[model samples]
Target: MHDSTQSRRTARNSLLIMVCTLLSRLLGIIKARVLGSVFGATAIADVINFTFNIPNNFRKLFAEGAVNAALIPAFSSLLGRNEKHRCVRLFALLCTFQSLLLIPLVLVSYFYGDGLIAFLSDFDANQVRLGGRLLPFFMVYLATISLASIFNGVLQAHENFLHAYLSPLLFSICVIFGVWFLSDRYGAMSMAYSVLGGGLLQGSYSYLMVRRYEYRFKPMLRPQNAPFKEVLVAWALVSLGMGMQIITQMVSFLFASHLSEGSVTAFTNSTIFYQTPYGIFFNAISAVSLPLMSRAAASNNAPLLRTYTRNSLLSLLALLLPSSIILFFLSRESVSVVLQTGNYTLADATLTALVLRPYLVFMVFSAWYALMLRLGYSANRHALMTRIVFLQNLLDIALMWVFLKLGLDIVSLPLANGIAYTLGLFILFFLLRDLFPLTKEARFFKGLLRIVLANLPVLAFCIFYKNLGLQWHESGSSFANLAYLMLIGSAALGIMLLSYKIARIPLLSLLRSKKHGGNLQGDNLIHLD
Candidate 1:
């Protein structure tokens, strides 16, 4: 009964995140169109994307990803034990430590920002100089959002998710309105200023949310505190993994710089599109999974842990597999409809689509891999997580070097990303197979096989849809391109759901399935049959 209640709660949270993520991503698409229309996928766009992304990468390494990975589990455990006071102290300590570290980072970016930008990007002298001016604003954003994530993690630990998704949505809105209203006046510089404003707003909202929850700021810095030490231990390991990610991102920028003019913009925007579905599906699940998994692992319940792991994987693959397949097949039309307006030309869209197709593989497998890491975090398996992240990053760089040398041009970026993630996924499967109860359930494999079978026809429909759309009109009008997308997308989704129904797969139940709740509620899931 408790598990069932948890399931409903998680469903409501996931539903909230999905709705907000959908809105934010759509606004994000509009932001892309504005940037493309106003700036095109040229040196300016490349510079803006690269410069901003560099600090955002640091934000992942130092702030949100690292903090959430460490803080969420500890927070969940503390809250579960009715130790809210200790949790607040832990939060304050982490914030102090983070401030101490991030202060130096912000200072470096301000003082030596251009040199850092130059090192991270391989742009020409002119582009480098232009990008240097924008780095400070993005770095400030990095600092603000990083700090806000502390409170964001607090909300997630409580399963009160007002701040987690809103920050990015605010960021996107700032970019869209700033570009639309101020582009003619302040030009691209207006976008930079808006980013600074967005970051302030993000920090503000998080602060307000914490206050509303009746949590006050109690700053305590005690390095010898065991909870603080434990989180530091986990955070250090997580930061190592995120550092590798940061390194790979920087290297990719360098690679993009050498590829061609505007290659950085293509690479960056392709990544944004790849994240659209991932944020919708896995982000919400992971949000709920981490807290519950932490509670289970803290109780040392192996069976429950395994169940959560297995079910999360099932939920991910159930929706992700079909979506990825269709999106992979429809990458071109999808890119055109979303980004091919204004300065984002047919040629530009084609370049981005080429990159986005292979990247779809990363989008799928990385979500699976991320769930495993969260499992590791919950179970306090930091060393193993470290090694897995290392292997993934190592393979990515090695494959990227090999692919670029093969002269695959800009497409080599995502191609290597796809291949590395695919390989790392198998390695994870081998290493973590014991944690998955698949062999215990013979029918699991059968269901997965059925899902694979279902995706086949979805694949066929996507291909047929693609060929059919080509006969009507390929480009020239965004409306025609969007209509083409709507037709194919609606059909592909219907086919996927219907196919799952024929196979007796409760797709909606999977969506709402909590860590301990796998059974269905009639009201919670759609009755497909």
Candidate 2:
């Protein structure tokens, strides 16, 4: 009964996070559309993308990836033991340490911004100068977001996911306002300033939310803080591992930089579209599952851990498979409607679609990889996770190098990423087999197979709809394109629903129950805990 209650809570929290994520992503898409319309795939676009990459990547490393991985599990463990004072002390230490650490880093980045930009991308003199000019503004985000990450960790430890996830919405709103009001006068630099604004707002909001949960910030650096020391050790391993993943993206940027004038923009734009659904569904599941899995691991509850992991995988596959199919069939049309306006041209959209196609092909593998990494963290397998990420990045870089050598150009980058992630997913599953024996779960596999098989009709309908020669972007009318997309999308969804009904899948019911605030039975849905 406790497990059932936890499962429902997980579901509820996951849904809340999903809604928040969806809104943030929607706003993000709007922001991207604004940028695309204003700048298209020009050198200005490339410069903006490249300049922001450094700070944004670091944000992922410190704020999102490593810090969260190391801090959340430890914080959750402390809270599980009812060690509120200790947790608060550790939180204060982390904020101070990260603040001191980031200040020097940001200072160096500001001073040597030009050299750093040149090293990351082989931009020409003008573009390099623009990047140097923009780097300092963007670098401020590193500090703001890093602090925000700590506050986020505190909120997640308390299971306050709504505010933690919703906080990003402020960032998007600020950027949109910047683009709308400031872009005309400041040009591309307006976006950089907007990033700083967004970061400040995001960090402030997260800090306030944490304080509401009784977490007061005190500046203290105690060397003997055992929990802080433990977090540092784990953080080092997690950062190194996750840092390599970010490096893979940096490598791709380098590769794209060497391509044509607009290649970097094309690559970045495609990535944004691909990550939208991924962020919405896969990330939401992982975020909500982490604290629960951490508690299970702390208590040495292997059964509970495995249950959470398996259910997350099942839910991911069920949702992501259909999303992948939809993206595959409509990559071009989707790109056309969303980004092919203003300064962005049909040619640019075509290039972006080419990149999105192969990226979406491996969406399921990417989702699996994310879930497995979270499980690794929950199980306190940071060393193993580090090794896996290192190997994955190594393989991806090698494949990318090979593709470039073969003269495959920009599309090769995403293809390499997809292949590498696929390899990593299989390897992770094999390593996790002992703790989470997926093959023995015949019912889970059966349902998964049904979900996959059930997607066939949806795929068929999409293909048929495409063959009907319906152009979503015809007549240069946004409404017509959106209407056409909805018509086809609704049909595809209906076919998927019908197929699931025939196959006795309970996804719709689970969603319905979740929507109606009804208790979900373990037997009715794949039990997650």
Candidate 3:
């Protein structure tokens, strides 16, 4: 009975988290629009992007991917054991240690900002110098936000969803306000300070909310005998794996930096836009699956773990397959509607649309690989995950080089990403063959193939429709162009749905499935043990 109640609570918390994430994405679009209008696809935006990537990468390494991956499972286990005091102590230690560490990291990044920017940025002399100037301020921004992420993760693990959800909203508020008030007077540099101020506000906001939960912070290095050390070490190792998965991001960024003054900004904006659907589907699956996987592992229910893993994989494919198609067809319209504003001209929109078309192809593959990695981690197959990460990274770099050599240009980066993800998925399957029967594996692949085949008609129709839409009168208004494309695109999507029904594919299987509460209610899932 207690287990049933606990499961209900987890489900509720997961729902809250998902809602918050969706809100963040919405705010993210708004913020991007504001920045796009103000800065456009110019050198100033490029410098801001370059400066921001430094801390953003670090955050992914520690706060989002690494720390949260380690903390949630370990913390869940600790809490499962009823060791509440120890859990609180662990949070305090991390908060304290990170606070001290961030100070130095921020200082170093700021003081040596110019040199670092010059080294990392492959750009014209003027752009490089400007990027370097933006680095110190952005470094401060990254540092504070990264620290805030720690608290956010803590709140997430505790299943305190509200505070965690609001943190990013707070960030977006500060940024919009800062840009609105200061961008005019101080120009591009003021945006940097706005980012820093937003970061501070976000961090303080999270910290205060955390205090309300009775998790007080203290500054001490007492090796508090707990799983903190083990988890930290494990997280570091896992981050190496996660970091490798994105090795192509760094490579592509470096290569793109060499292209032109505005190339980096264009690429970054393209990435952000493409990431929206990825985040919606990928994050949704991972959020629900990880805790379930951890629970299954803790209870020693291998079969249930396998079942959950399979469901999560299918859910990802079901979403990504269609999303990739939509992205390919609507790339231009999406860019115009979401990003084309103010300083962002038609040319900038066209460029971003061009790059985004190929970038979303790996959505399904990467989502599946990410699920496999988490499943492996939950089952304590850390070594397997580590090796996969290493190989995936190696493959990414090799593919990036091949694409460049072949003159594939900007699209090659995502193409490399797609190749790596494809390889990773197969490797994960082979490694988990015992858990997933050979026949079942065949069925999964068949289902995925059917989904792709099912969407082909829709893709073809959209291609034809888009050509026609482009021909209909040339209105200089971005909105008019977008509306026409969307009208045509909607018709295409409608046809796609009809085709899915004719093909007898479960087109909305994911949506039809039980959502948050459904995972815990009126189901035999709990008895799978």
Q: What's the residue-level lDDT of 327 in candidate 3? A: 75
lDDT string for model 2 (1-529, tens) is: 6645765766777788778988987897689878888888899999998788778777777778788999999888788777788888898889989988889887887799888888889899989889998888888887988999899988998888888988889999999888789988999888888998999999999999999977877778885544887788889999898778777878899999999877898999998888888988876778877887788778777766776676677778777888889888888888888777767887888788899889889998888887888888877788898899999999999999999999999988999999999999989989988767777766557657767898999888878877887664633328778787777778888888788777666552222122112222333444454
The model with the greatest TM-score is: 2
What does candidate 1 score on TM? 0.84
Enumerate residue pairs that collide in model 3: none
- Cα RMSD to native, each candidate? 4.2, 4.2, 5.2
Top-down TM-score ranking: 2, 1, 3
Position 337, candidate 2: lDDT: 81
Task: Give the residue spans of candidate 3 off by over 4 A.
Answer: 1-19, 32-50, 109-140, 184-189, 242-247, 254-270, 332-355, 406-409, 434-470, 473-477, 491-529
- Top of the candidates by lDDT: 2
Candidate 2 lDDT trough over 10 residues, lowest sum: 511-520
lDDT of 1: 0.77
| TM-score of candidate 2 against the unseen true structure | 0.85
Clashes of each: 0, 0, 0
What lDDT, from 0 to 1, does candidate 2 have? 0.81
- State in Å the error of residue 256, model 2: 4.6
Worst window of 10 by summed lDDT in candidate 1: 520-529
Residue 320 shift from truth in candidate 1, angstroms: 1.0
| lDDT value, residue 356 of candidate 3 | 78
